[model samples]
Target: MDLSRPRGSLWREFFLVASLLACGIRQASGQIFITQILGIKGYSTILAVDNVPEDVQEYSWYRGANDSAGNMIISYKLPSTQQPGPMYTGRERVNREGDLVIRPTALNDTGNYTVRVVASNETHRATGWLEVVELGSNPSLSVNATSLVENMDSVAANCHTNATNITWYVNYGPISGSDRMRISPDGKTLVILRIRRSERTLQCAIESFPDIFQRSEVISLTVSYGPDYVLLRSNPYAFNGIMKAEIGSQVEMECVAYSLPALKYHWIHNGSLLNISDATMNLSSLAWEQMGSYRCIVENPVTQLTFYEDIRIQAPRILSVVHREFSILEPTVVLLIVWIVAAGVYLCGVLIHALINRYSNRTNRAT
Candidate 1:
């Protein structure tokens, strides 16, 4: 192709090919210079020279200085196709605009490049640098929202970097295409339609050749759920879901639920709301009327969820009441039993002394 003309021009008005007129040529009349290019690693990029004469006959691209024959990459004469020079590599091709295109550029490609343009009267040369970047730093991860309601809200995540190979993971497991997820073509942006509690952690990584793996910082999302798993109990004693306490004793009853953002607790007794409105219910000087079924309501305000649970707060009933009464009288009854036993031992001692005296007197009188 005639590389001297503009990109849209089809006519072979001029040509710049490899294998330059192996001679030292000064910078021609025009202020022509190679346009500097920043190329991405593992991607296609181009290098071109600007302000060239329209009547050019040939073009040559060189690796570095055009001082020797071995430095020429490619050159072409008028009416001739591009031919490789001694330094030509198979990875480059010149476009119609005399721009050198490199496919799959690399880090070693970051260096100076020179282009020589030929016209009917003179030859011109220009030099510029190409910088191919392979990012060594960690990628950045971002999310649209950090907090969401489970199964009702969504989140969008983005990984920002110039990396070509992007992989995403949720909770340390690789993620693939799914109905609730969306991934951009460049693997930069991701969206989840519905957020769940199980997917709290997310990450993106650049996977390159030769064991080059760079991971982004973790993106954490909070999924709100629950108000279930309700439990009701007291500190001293609770058996079979029933809170046990004694009369005239102060007791505490606690209600709890498993939920995010905490839960609001409400106590209930006799099918009516009690004044106690926290996770704890305190009762003192309990009587028979105070012993009955007690209930509590748990709610998650964020999730708009409510859970109900009931427990019996029985002080003592039937045999349990008898046992309680016996425990109260135990010390007094033990003291009375001790006094009676002591009195009985003293009476037995007196009776033995009297019998011994009577027997001795009878023996003496007989003697």
Candidate 2:
């Protein structure tokens, strides 16, 4: 890298970047493209160059279209060395690759910036524009209509901003022109011919630089949809398509559906509407009367769509646990009683045999 800029080199460098300082100039020897970029107020940004010759010895930067060497901001030697020029401000620096970096940029930074490169004996230079802007007002979004029904309603959304780099987002992601969506020429407005529930979150931002967003407040719209696919759920759920609960046990049946504006639930037993109106139906101490096809009707008031689902419930016969327990205990009790009786009989036989033995002995002794 050409790290040093001697006072004698100022006269030579003055003529290097001297021209009309137009954006992206092509020299007679080779081509050097200085990319145009944006700079935010009080922030850092880069003025990059492309197609630089590999045999570069030094890089020099100048401010504006000035032809005099006094406009030189800074210079960088071939590698990492830097020399602050006469016009050097504390905010400017040149990287090893010959790019100009400015930090905490000001409004005055907006203008044509020029860079000169010296490779071997050839001199190449180019200029580009840099527009510095303050982070402006947060974009405001307004829609003509909301709470619309899916596929049946359309809305016009407008983003209020003076920034030319308008970008639109749906559900926090970038969106482009589609069959159902259209954007105005200036990107200040968007129109959706048909709205869907999944496209409810709408937003806009200024992306003057790629991946950098000055975002606006999000707009959440409601698109009322169907009361679709009536669903049945239960506590102590159904077995083999039949909800079987022992008598005196409770069974809870719940109705569910996908709906907007909430769903109203009503229950039916054996084709007759029951008094129950909520999503839950509890059969406490289940009786035979509670046994039958329980139909749940789900309704969406806004969409006027209704769906129904059914769950079959049955109460098994009451279990006689006490009798069953006694049945299990009877055989065990009988076996125990037989064991005691046999033990007593064996004790009697042994006592009688001992008495007979003693009598016989006494008779023999008397003899």
The sequence of per-residue lDDT tens digits that candidate 1 reaches over residues 101-145 is: 777777888877888888899988787666677747878899998
Error of 2 at 143 (Å): 1.1
In model 1, the Cα lDDT at residue 327 comes to: 50
Q: Which parts of model 1 are misplaced by more than 4 Å?
A: 1-139, 161-164, 179-186, 235-245, 319-367
Leading candidate by lDDT? 2
Model 1 TM-score (2 dp): 0.45
Instruction: Give the alpha carbon lDDT tens digit for every residue of 172-232 in model 2.
Output: 9989978789999999998988788888888998864444577888888999998768778
What would the TM-scores of all predictions be? Answer: 0.45, 0.55
Off by over 4 Å in 2: 1-45, 48-92, 110-140, 159-169, 172-179, 182-189, 203-217, 235-242, 268-278, 316-367
lDDT of 2: 0.79
